[model samples]
Target: MTTGIAARIADRIRHSGPVSVAAFMTEAMFDPREGYYATKNPIGAGEDFITAPSVSQMFGELIGLWCAQVWMDMGQPARFHLVELGPGTGQMMSDMVRAGRAVPGFLDAARITLIEASAALKMVQGRTLTPMGVEALWLDRLEDVPDGPAIIVGNEFLDCLAVRQAVKQDGHWHERMVGLDDDEDFTFVMGPRLGMDADLVPARLQDAPDGTLVEFRPGDRQLVDVLGRRFSDHPGRALFIDYGPAQSEPGDTFQALRGHEKTDPLAAPGTADLTARVDFEQLGALARAGGLDVDGPVEQGRWLKSLGLEMRAAALIRSAPEKKSVIARQVMRLTEPDQMGELFKVMTFSTPGLPKAPGFAPEA
Candidate 1:
């Protein structure tokens, strides 16, 4: 398969015309033949960005504990689906299964299902999960999981689902698009078109000043709806962790990363990690509409702290003096104010009958 995504995109433009920024992003990240993640590792050191699981093992361990608590709260179902929306390198799922093994009868009773889009990543996952004695299966879509009691986890998943950009101009919202500028390189342009619904534009954003561009994920609502409906039928909980604003705010969250640094998003299609921040408020409505329980839009710092990350950090630091500082720093990175603490968010959604999952409200 040709790995020249940028070239393929250029060809499309030459054949047709300018495309929307969303269309460019969709092709760049998901073209399958040579998309960024589909072709290479986009996490950690030399790549575009680092996710939570890549940050440290402790991060996954803590989430594992949270899932365990959720499962136990659900009365320890004899058969439950442990679904991870994007099991990159299978690290988080592997760490989770390892931690869950501490609980009696947990591993034997659980079925691991990974919602992954790349066959390359899935092969890597098999090497990791198979050794852990986990029977895992990967699918590109969540709906294929076959409805059941599920505990869902998506670390940095929603942001990459693709988003549309809208820039307020002349006192009205216009869908931002990608077109050939005077230089003939891709540049942003605004179309005199409104989004799905303009009347319901957040009250706070009614006065969007001209030239101020904002990005949003209509897909987030659809994802929430699917998970909410699935869990509503079987009754489960989902934990989502990602970088973004807690409340709905407007900004051009579209960003690209290459070599661990910010790059021109238009510079290289299918070669950089293109992403945007998540909007939890909008997602809350979707979950609610599906008749599920929703909680939080909390900062990752507070959520992890509330879930006892401090105690875990302190214990590990105490056990090994040599690794104390390392443990402390990881905890800070995970929950401190300046790092991922405020930038990243944690939200939980549960079925109608399920109790509020830990790490968020409904701690009942």
Candidate 2:
């Protein structure tokens, strides 16, 4: 018996020729009835996969401090938007808010906003955040965020945005699509040639050898455009921490995770989490083109260390000496080169003229 999402997708593919990978992903991940996020909480232990914020409280606390510092750099706006995109379980924001207490007036000055589409997750977030004595405004889209100076934070969020993949064939790029196979199961198929525009394939991989697969997220570009316009009208800074290469490269990184194990992305739609590697270089370029200042796509481990991850861990251990081993393991998992440390990266974008964000080097 096919899953609800799988059956729906099969029907669509049967009626239409083929759907772009991005379209397939969007439907699988966002379909109201059975989409992954729509039906379940997919973060934390025993979930599909664990995010950094779930790994330890330190991650969220450090991020909170970073935002507080940025708020100070913004000259302490009387009332500025402190927005979080795709706040998973509200753990990061909770930790951030807790840490923000370190800086007087930071919490008072913050107008907390969470941009989330999943109603189920929103309920979960409500439970997580409500007890902290912090009231938050929840919206379904970024455009709905009220106009004002803002500091946006997204952790492990960008990877969830759908991406379209193209394969180089005979020196031309063909859009990779999801189509029903002979058995009516989902499968990858090559679609129409991109011709002149090359379907917006990044220049860096335009001339890649035949058979190279390049992925691009139109959503990312659109998101940057929206943020750029928002920042242009007001002052804002945004931080995105995710796993992706610091430089753009051509490859197929589309994948799925279920119960912390890698699974076939096209096997069962809407039942597993689907994601692709973020292209930080391309993202930075888009932000720059949108007239925003971009900061390092620094390794997450280095960025966290620069923000004093070790110091924070030590403090936490000193407070709970009995949990020293557990705390040490969390730090190693978060910052060790072979672990999440090197694979994940941190980047910031701000309206031009603001001081550089914390942990990032001064502009040359």
Candidate 3:
């Protein structure tokens, strides 16, 4: 069945021309009728990957405290938005609200909003968060949330948004595309770069030699700009935790996973998880244009340590001896540079008055 899907797209390209990698990824990851995120849970043991918040409670707790700071920084707005994007199983949010109680008056002043697209995961989230005293309203887009002072968190969110790819050829960058091959299998091709993209390619990429493909996400930047502009009208901050970097570099970061195994991305359009590394630098630029104070694209390990995750973990371990192994593994996943620690980056954008956003070096 997977082979048939790949073959169909591939054959289209063979007869036609190259399709942008973005077009292919969109179909592969979100065809709705049969897409990766559309059809699969893609988390926990049965899935291709696990997210940081899922690995430990400490992660979500710290973020909870971070939001509290945003509230405090804003002089504790009587009503504010505590929003979480793509909240999975609602575990992180539950942990967040629990930890945030430490902040005096935080719970009373905030409304929890979650943007989730999966009915299956939403049910899981409902079950997990129902016990918490807080009410969580679910939505399909952040825009649905009303305008207000907000502290938003997006865990492993931006990476999954569709991205476009370009490869340097003859000192000219061409957009890499997907199309059908002779067997109707998905195939790669190059298209003439059009629109404002020619002006947007990184300066380093402009002169690169042939055969080098660069992945990018206009959708992400557009989303970032929207969120930034939305918050621009009010006072608040946004924190993004995902796999990427503080700076832009060249490489194809796209991949597919099926039951924790690497697979042909195009082979099973609806079965495998499809994702790529986020481009935080691009996000930063878009946010700035929309009028926001952008903070570090800091490494996740560094950010967690700066937030004192170690102390938090040690406290949890002391409280319960039976959970030692679980605590240890969670610590490793959040702090080990090779795991999600270093590879996953954390960044926040804020309005003018936000005190230096927690978990990173203050911007000069």
**What TM-score does each of the candidates earn?**
0.93, 0.98, 0.93
For candidate 1, write residues 1-364 as lDDT tens digits: 1347766666676688767777989888888888776787666765667787887787787888888899899999999998999888888988888878888888777888999887778888899888888888778898899767998999999888888877787777888877766665677766656855554455456687887766767777678778767875786888899888766788877889888889899886887888888877777766787777888878888888887778877887788879987887788788788899999888888877677678666451
Name the candidate that leads on TM-score: 2
Report lDDT per candidate. Answer: 0.80, 0.92, 0.80
Steric clashes per prediction? 0, 0, 17
Better of 2 and 3 by lDDT: 2
Best by lDDT: 2
Write the residue-wise lDDT of candidate 3 on 61-123 in tens digits. Answer: 999998887788888999999999889778899999999988889999988999987777778
Model 3: residues >4 Å from true position, as ranges?
1-17, 362-364
Screening candidate 2 with a backbone cut-off below 3 angstroms (N, C-alpha, C), the clashing residue pairs are: none
Minimum summed lDDT over a 10-residue window in model 2 is located at: 194-203
Cα lDDT of candidate 1 equals 0.80
Model 2, global lDDT: 0.92
How many pairs in model 2 have backbone atoms within 3 A of each other, for residues 3 or more apart or on separate chains, i.e. clashes? 0
Give the per-residue lDDT digits (tens) of candidate 2, residues 1-364: 2788888778888898889989989988999888998998999887889999889999999999999999999999999999999999999999999999999999999999999988889999999998999899999999999899999999999999999999989888899999988877789999999776484788687789999999989999999999999999999999999999988899899999999999999988888999999999889988998999999899899999999999999999999999999999999999999999999999999999999889997421
